[model samples]
Target: MNTRTGKVIVNQTITADGYSAGLDQTEEHPFGDDGGDGWGSSLHSWMFDAGEENRAEVDQINAASAVIMGRNMFGPVRGEWDRQWNGWWGDNPPFHAPVFVLTNHAREPQPMEGGTTYHFVTDGIESALKQARAAAGDGDVSIHGGATTINQYLAAGLVDELRLHIVPITLGAGVRVFDGVPPRKLEQVTARAASTVLHVTYRVLA
Candidate 1:
C-alpha cells in the first residue's frame, strides 16, 4: 500500500565516544578541535566520496522538498558576524528545498542562490515540522542535524527514519548523540558498509 505522510529523517555522524558536533564549535573551529585535530576532514571525505554509493543515497535524501535544523547547527558565527552566513555550504548548497531553522531569536527568511530558503521558526519544533510538511507536499520532510534538535524530535517520537554514519575515531569528551534518549525499539531498515563509514538506517518501531 502507498501512503503519503510527513517523515523526519536525521543525518548525523558521531565519534566512537558518541560526540555528535564536537567541543566548542566556534567559527575558528567549526567542527571543533581548534584546527589541529578535528573530524571535519574525515567527515567531508566520508560524505563527498563520489566513488562510494552512499553519495547517491545522500543525494536522494536531499531530493525531498524541505529540511529542518536547530539554531546552533546553523552557526554561532551569526552572533558576532556582520555578514549573513547561510551555512558552511557555499552559494550552491546541496539542499535545494526550503530549509526551516528552529530558533528563539527571530530573523528574516533568507533565500539563497540555489532553491534553498532558510526560514527561522521561533514558535517551536512542532511549528517547524508543520511548515516543512506543508512545503514538502508529496515528498518527504527531512530533519537535518546538530544533536539537540534530533533528540528533541526523537524524544517526542516524531522521527520516521534515522540514517547514521558512525566513524571509528573517538572523542573522549564532547556532545553525545543519544545522550538521554529513553530506551526505544528501532527496526533496522538497512545497513551498509563503505570504506570509511558504516551506514545504518533505522525506522522507529515504537
Candidate 2:
C-alpha cells in the first residue's frame, strides 16, 4: 500500500507523568481516575476551562479532514454492536469529517448528524489508515485517542507529527502513552505554555 498523502497526526492530552487515562474506564467514568466526573473532564479541562487561552490548539483538533480512533475511545460497547450506541457525543460529534474506528468486530458505516460519519474497520490499523487517508484527500488525518491506539501507530512508524497537550497532574496507575513503542528521535516544532496546559508539537524526525 502507498503511504498516506496527508500527515498522520496524533493529538492527545496527557498528564505530567505521561498517563493518558486512569484505570477502570467505564461509560460513566470515561477517563477513570483522571478526576473527571465524565468524559474528558479531567485531562481536557484545558480546553473547557481555559477557553481562549488554548483556543487555537482546540480548533486545530477539529480541523482535521478525517480521524482514526480506537474502538474503546469511541464508546464502551464491547464485543458485538449489541445496543444502539452511536458515540459519547450526542447526534453530532465534534469531528465534522469521516471517522474510522479500529475494531475487531464488523459494523456498517454509521452516519450521524452533521457531516460526521463513523466507519468501522476490522481489517487492521493500516487498513483503517488507508481508508482514512483516502477520505481525507489532501487534508490532514488525526489519530484520535486512547493510549493503546496511538501506541500501535507510533510503533509502526505511521505517525508523522505528534501534538501533545501536557497537563500538570499525574495518574500513577492508568492508561499510559508509548508502552511498547521503541526509542525514536523527534524534532521539536513548538512548545507554548497556556494557563491550564503546555502545548508541545513534535515532528517525527525518523
- Using TM-score as the measure, the top candidate is 2
Per-residue lDDT tens digits of candidate 2, residues 1-206?
Answer: 76547789999999999989998888888888776664667688898888788889989998999999999999999999999889888998999999999999998999998899999999999999999999999899999888899999999999999999999888798888888999989999999999879999999877
Evaluate model 2: give its TM-score: 0.96
Tens digits of lDDT, candidate 1, 58-136: 7757777899998777876554336677787778878899999987777888898779888989899999999999899
Candidate 2: 10-residue stretch with minimal lDDT: 33-42
Computed on alpha carbons, the lDDT of every model, listed in order, comes to 0.78, 0.91
Runs with alpha carbons beyond 4 Å of true place in candidate 1: 1-3, 34-39, 49-53, 78-83
